[model samples]
Target chain A: MRWEGRAWVFGDNVDTDQIIPGRYLRRVSYDELGRYAMTGADPEFPEKVREGDILVAGRNFGCGSSREQAVMALQQAGIACVVAESFARIFYRNALNRGLPTVEAREDPTEIVEDGERVVVDLDELVLRSESGEVPLREPPEFARRAWREGGLLELARRNPERPPWR
Target chain B: MATVVERFLSEKCGERVEAGDVAVVEPDVIMLHDGSGATALRTLRELGTERVKRPDRVVLIFDHSVPPSSVEAANRQNELLAFARRHGIERVHVDEGVCHQILVERGYARPGRVIFGGDSHTPTAGGVAALGFGFGGTDMAFTLLYGELWLRVPRTIRVHVTGDLGPGVTAKDLALTIVGELGAGYADYAVLEYTGLPERLPVGDRMCLCNLATEAGAKSAYVPPAEGPERLRPGDADETVELDASEVEPVVSVPDAVDRVRPVGDVQGEEITRVFVGSCTNGRYRDIRAFTEALDALGGPDPNVRIVVVPASRRVLLRLARDGTLERLIELGASVAPPGCGPCLGEHLGVLGDDDVCVSTANRNFPGRMGSVEADIYLASPLTAAVAAARGELADPREELPRTALERVSGS
Candidate 1:
């Protein structure tokens, strides 16, 4: 799916805590999760995040704690996709399983997108657009993309077992 | 040639993994955590590597956010299970217990051996007297595909603990104390060897020390094998070794100490908010007992503090019930999360609120570690953590718990 919204850029190692804190975990529902999205990093995130909003971050984007709650919090908050220089492996999988797409590319999003600047993300074409310019970004692995489209890897494997060739 | 881990670290920037001048390559067991299993399997499939190499030597765990707080999370864990089945890895332990916790109880982790895992906390296994280190998904994949993994023999730093720990103090505190002093990246690529006190420290304390070695950025950590009153003993000692554990004093330095320890308070602290107890590191019976003893001493938890305790394994949970420790914890107002990861990761039961402060016994207090980046995390010993939980503030419990509990636990 393609989405576009203002961008929120973060620095490297923006851990799961900054995305969603543990104290809020007592309430597990996604509805409550969105309220805590980036709440630690940005308290006003819930009210400010618009549908289709994209989060761009630096390296180690989801380091610390392997809680999938961070992914849920972001997706439930209406975050369309995350573009980071790198992603903690667990968080990367957690994102794909929940149908939240993440990409790893070397370019700095801070240079191209500001806190409130409009941006567009295209998963199919693997490109990001903002007022500053359009940039080519790395795409999620093929299986990951297929997984996202089919609701997750398991469903994708169930429907098209031979699709990725790896399976 | 640089080892798979070293090469990958070199290629991946930002994380900045550098190979040391001397590479130590010895691993008795290879542990894989969560999505890393799937990744390793896929890498094997792609590489068409043969034999899957000693499936018995591998241990797989699902501790990292895969216990399924939601349908999606559950599905992901299912995929991991399927992947392991396909790979023919017999040592798979999924959603059963924390990896380090189970390894020690199951006796899969032995001291003086090399150990590796895809999860960073693999170093925690060293508590059982193994050389524990963590690698990435690709490295895990490479290792499983080929029985041998390359390495950069790291300069060994030996920390000698000679003095008796005060009451309520534990290896968890020792680890936190070291990490707090060393800061997160002090030992970036070093191998830490903890020695001294075979009779003084319990097995749980050793695990806590080795577990937090990663916090100091050490590549891997170990405590020299010593003959305990148990079945385990330090293996053959090499004569060429430069450092002698016996000669060192009871001191810790980010450098001078075998494993540099950076104090949590010095690294940075913001405010007081929530406290968590559990995870593979400090989630054993001993860990829980420490917390309970502290809580009992304090009478109960403070009104404002939100304390959550998760037993490491079902066995542990049952044991606590049988011993009435569970009732006391519940009565004391400590919320007992299901025997899994609980709040260790933000996936289940309890998540942290925005801008909250969390003190936990689990390793890695990184952003969102307890659930929010805006929230600050402080790593501390179980005693510190227990006392903090009881008073609803961060306080070391060395001065709190009775001396009887401090008596070195036999058989560790």
Candidate 2:
């Protein structure tokens, strides 16, 4: 599958609070939630973000909290994909379970793709092509990619109504 | 041929499974709190379902914002009550401190069972040999509707702890030592399998280790069950680390990073403005009793230092109240907040002002964790926290305790 988006660059250790602070956790408003996405690290981030924009960052991205809302808030704001050098384990899993594509490239995407540079993400051939050059991407385990392909675990369950013990 | 985590996953999946396998398995317990319960339920409802698949397997906890801190919080709780009623989820606990504590007290967590909650510290249940981990609200919603979740089998990292702890060297200190020795990201995407004389460490102490595993980027922590519950040894470790508990000193996780730990002596006498002595990490009977006892011995804290004690659960509070321990803590100048996660996450309770420094018993000292991003949070044990509050500075508790009391651990 092919994906296209502009890169929204961030530095290392971009925590969940930075994605969306703890103060907004009690409520359930997508618009209200989207207004605060990335506000901690960049106050004008919410307004600057556009639909189908990809978030690019360094190591330990989304390094705090089990709150799935952080990923959901980004998804709501139309964050097409997140490519990081490394990700907090839970955040990586959370994004997948929510059907949001996340790629971990050995080569730091932040160095290859600059801010607002439109790049193409290829899941089929395992490559990220930008005007600068073509950077190879490591494909996640097949099961994880399958979940993403199916649009998340919830969608996967809808396909297999029998639940576990797939007899 | 399978490790403990793999075996547990296999059992839950109703078939033999291997490491590196990803499958959806319905866990025995699915816990949620006021902060995320409504979202989970709403997600399930939006999926075109009004009834939960198994209400008996779900628990709703109202500990994050108890006693109605605001109208919004109150409205959220009311909606949660209605949602819980519409469905058959009868296992609801209000003012029960934290969901992790309630998960154990309600007998929902035990050895060999897979437990999932919406909070990160849910892995605290692993201290009791249960396979507990955290998930997001959407996953919780899916689990609530179908009683299962899709999970990736995490690689196991065996942590073998040796030696007996010396004077005032508790499990909290050992955890800090391990976090410091091994970087916070050492256990990333891995499961921590703790072995070697684990029974010597009580449930509370073991929970402390598992609770802090998140800071080390661990997906989960497990202490295999000792009884009839089947035990599976970990597979060939991707990595191994050995720790000598006796060598551990009372340490602290300074502001801005959970892994950046140093001996308390290094940062001692730093004037403290506030102190908190509770959270799932160190808010059990063992911890609170230790702090209150330390206060009694030290003649309580200085009036200038702000101190708040939050019981981990309603059951813990009752246990202390029944034994006259609660009154003693109150009389000693501790402003006891209702049983819940008070002030740990920097909500309406005990928020720190700018430039303030707080010594706390909770996990993680990340920026803005307690309140202001500029304020510093020093993570320590309850005894150390009480001492800091009493002394109005970050002083080591070992210096004040009697030498006899500082003797070897009870089991050792």
Candidate 3:
């Protein structure tokens, strides 16, 4: 699985409030969440995002709230993938559940990939490529790759509904 | 070494498991609140499966909007009831104060058991030595139907807490202090096992620490079953840190961030508009009883301050009512919201207005958590909040309370 997009840089500890504030949680609609995505941090973020755009940030991206709406907001906002120094556990798993690819860069991906630079993420090879160079990141397990490639856990479950979530 | 998380996973997998190994395990309980319950059900429809494999293990509650904040909120709650009925989910708690507390009060959080919930503070169940934590929508949806979910084993981070809790210093204060010193998210994706516990520590205080484990970016927190919880064994930890809690005193996490903690004296005179004394983090019967005692000593909260008391569950609220503790809060001019999340989520009930600065016992203080985006939220222990409410500003909980008050409140 490969994704290539322009990078959008965010800072460390981008909490769910910054992703989508709690006040907006009242909507409970993924589509509503997208229009307001990242508006908490930068009001113009939603307008600026394009389909297949990438988010690259520092450590602890998605650090607060298990809202899961945060991940949905990003997905609906057309964020292709999130590459960070590290991700909070819930956000990481939630992204996978939503079929949003999140790759952890052991080193600062920001230092290697600049904002607005075109980067390619090869999930199969676990490599992130930009004008700077190719950075080797850890690959997710086979099932995680399939989940993202297959659109997300919802689709995966829909396809296999007998017992659901076949191992 | 296997932490409790690791031990639980290792046992489930019948193989050695360590931190960072991804494994799937069945949870003993899956709790959903009004906020996530509606979404989880929607996911079921999306997945085209109206039935869950283990309806008996699924628990639903209406804590996010107890009485319903609006017609939309009420309708959403009604839909949840219909879904519960359709799915044959019988262990539903519509009047419960919060999911985490009711899970415990109802005896669902068995020691050494793994539990999942929709809210992040689900770690509150860890106070009982259970591997209780939370996840998001698809995960919750998948877990409900499949009875299993994936998790990466987290390395155990042992926080050895020593020294007697000082006058008016609470486990909430200690939790804030840890986040302040270590920085928020210090325990990112790690299990925080509390050791060197003072024998006198009460269950309420232990729950307070575990509940805020989410604030510290912990995957979960535990007090070790040896702390008095039955039917569990303490798991080995990989790393350890020592904390000299001897000098710990009343502290508050200043507005906008749960980790931005400072000594209460630093902001003693900060103007206050509200003081909330309840949430799953600090809304147990003991917590209510202690804060009421403090409010009684203060002759009631400052007339200008609005105090909102939320019980963690109907069980706790009933006990408080029977014991007249609820009456004491109302007598102190506190408006007691029904058993539920209340203003903690900020959708309704005691929502802060523009520029409102509130000292609350809820977990998060992220922008707009309790109401207006412009409002400021300070997280404090119920005792600290009680004192601050009485004086109408941020103040030390121990400023006037005698040492006996602390001892009596910390009773085992």
Candidate 1 lDDT tens digits, B100-217: 7777777777754567677767777666666666664545665665544545545455565565554344565555565555555456556666766632566777777787776566
Q: Write candidate 3's Cα lDDT for B360-393 as tens digits.
A: 8888887777877788899988888888788888
> Which scores better on TM-score, 1 or 2?
2
Q: Rank the candidates by TM-score, best first.
A: 3, 2, 1
Task: Quantify all predictions' global Cα lDDT against the true fold.
Answer: 0.63, 0.79, 0.81
Per-prediction DockQ: 0.12, 0.40, 0.54
Tens-place lDDT per residue, model 2, B1-412, is: 5677788888898887666777678899888998778667656654556557889988999988787677777887898999888887899898867888888777888777898888777778878878887877777777777777777788888888888777777788887778788777778878887777554578888888889887787878876544443454445566678877768788898877888898898999899989898899999988888888777778888878888899898778888999998999888878888889898877767988887899999887776767676788999987778778888888776887666545533222
- Range of the 10 consecutive residues with the lowest summed lDDT in candidate 1 chain B: B249-258
**Candidate chain B TM-scores, in order:** 0.78, 0.95, 0.95
Clashes of each: 57, 2, 1
By descending lDDT, how would the candidates be arranged?
A: 3, 2, 1
Fraction of native contacts (fnat) of each candidate: 0.17, 0.31, 0.58
Candidate 3 per-residue lDDT, tens place, A44-127, comes to 898889999999888888877788889889989999999888888888878877789888876777778887889998877878
Candidate 2, A1-167: lDDT as tens digits: 67898888898777787787666676446446877788667778888899999998887888878777788889887798898888897787678767888888778777777888998988888888888887778878776787788787656655653463122
